[model samples]
Target: MSTKMIFINLPVEDLNRSKAFYEAVGWKVNADFTDENAACIVVDDNICLMLLTKTFFTTFSQRPIADTVAATAAAYALALASADEVDVLTDAAVAAGATEEHCPDKRAQEAEVGMHGRTFIDPDGHQWEPFYMAYQAA
Candidate 1:
């Protein structure tokens, strides 16, 4: 059998605050399973962000939780249909109080050729990148 990613669990200090941050950036919660300590932020039809309060998250693992606020060990990147979509999403993130880490810019040297991308940091400093590729005909 093949593996597929259905959910990503992120530990947060405040569940409500994390939910609000995601909501501001156009994500909705899965009400069927979300609660005061855990919220499922739907990213797409197959992707979801499981936001769990620190205390609740500890129940699942024994490893020390990474301090997201002060560390940059990982990031989430999303692809859009067009370069304009990247700008639009980045703008929405800014309006939602997310810090813009990198503005959208073209990278002709990469495999995407004329692609553009931007990065933003969520409230807890989780990095997210939105990108669009303009591929040349082979």
Candidate 2:
């Protein structure tokens, strides 16, 4: 089967601010698909995001956009290859204005599941989890 690319679409109140936040956290914006109303954040070769202004985003759906500040519509999670990378990404997100989702004691849940990660809420209140999971060879 052919590989399918993933494009996550998020509606934002402020296009520039949201774009800046993503850029500050190290994701490159693809100008090829970006304009004043939207930006394409490249997470990788196969995964990316289309950050659109609420007004522009609404054109795709009849329903009103979810108020991310008040309710979480979904959580975006990225899988890292190493535990240290998880920490680095999380720290970068925090420095870039993302809020931690869980408390310190509960943030690292590696011991129980062989997975370590951190969750953060972005400026627009979108939840993101950067995690690492060790693959056990059978």
Candidate 3:
């Protein structure tokens, strides 16, 4: 089967707050699909996030929605074009009220090739790793 991209549903205790946080980081909402129960955050042409209220979110799953602030059940990572961009984005995250979980660090083996990364926690404590991997000559 051919693969196509879609949305990721994140259960949030406060839909408005989560929506605001993402908006501060430059995500746009798809009003056509948004309501009091959920907000469709557009990440890219094919990527999006369905930010659902906790009550509405539970309806779609048998398992309980994880408390992202209390425990890390999962993490989302994105790569940057350069190590400097990792630092730049991390700074922006902090300015947006995200907690800096770790300082930027270089991977020893990767250091020679200039790869580096850092981690941060969003308003709801979701972990995100923004990293940069340098190109290597084949």
Per TM-score, the best of the predicted structures is 2
Of 1 and 2, the candidate ranking higher by TM-score: 2
Which model is ahead, 1 or 3, in terms of TM-score? 1
RMSD each, Å:
3.1, 2.2, 3.0
**Tens-digit lDDT track for model 1 on 1-138?**
435767888888888888988887788899987988799999877789999999999988999888877887588888889878889888888888788884433334443466678888888778888887766621
lDDT of 2 by residue, 33-63 (tens): 9999999999888899999998899999999
Off by over 4 Å in 1: 1-5, 103-112
RMSD of 2: 2.2
Give candidate 2 regions above 4 Å deviation: 103-110
Would you list the rank order by lDDT, best first? 2, 1, 3
Give the distance in Å from residue 137's predicted Cα in candidate 1 to where it truly belongs. Answer: 6.5
Lowest summed-lDDT stretch of 10 residues in model 3? 102-111
By summed lDDT, the worst window of 10 consecutive residues in model 1 runs over: 103-112
Error of 2 at 84 (Å): 1.2
Candidate 1 global Cα RMSD: 3.1
- What TM-score would you give candidate 1 relative to the actual structure? 0.84
Q: What TM-score do all the candidates reach, one by one?
A: 0.84, 0.90, 0.82
| Clash counts for the predictions, in order | 0, 0, 0
Report the C-alpha displacement of residue 9, candidate 1, in angstroms. Answer: 0.7
Better of 2 and 3 by lDDT: 2
Clashing residue pairs in candidate 3 are none
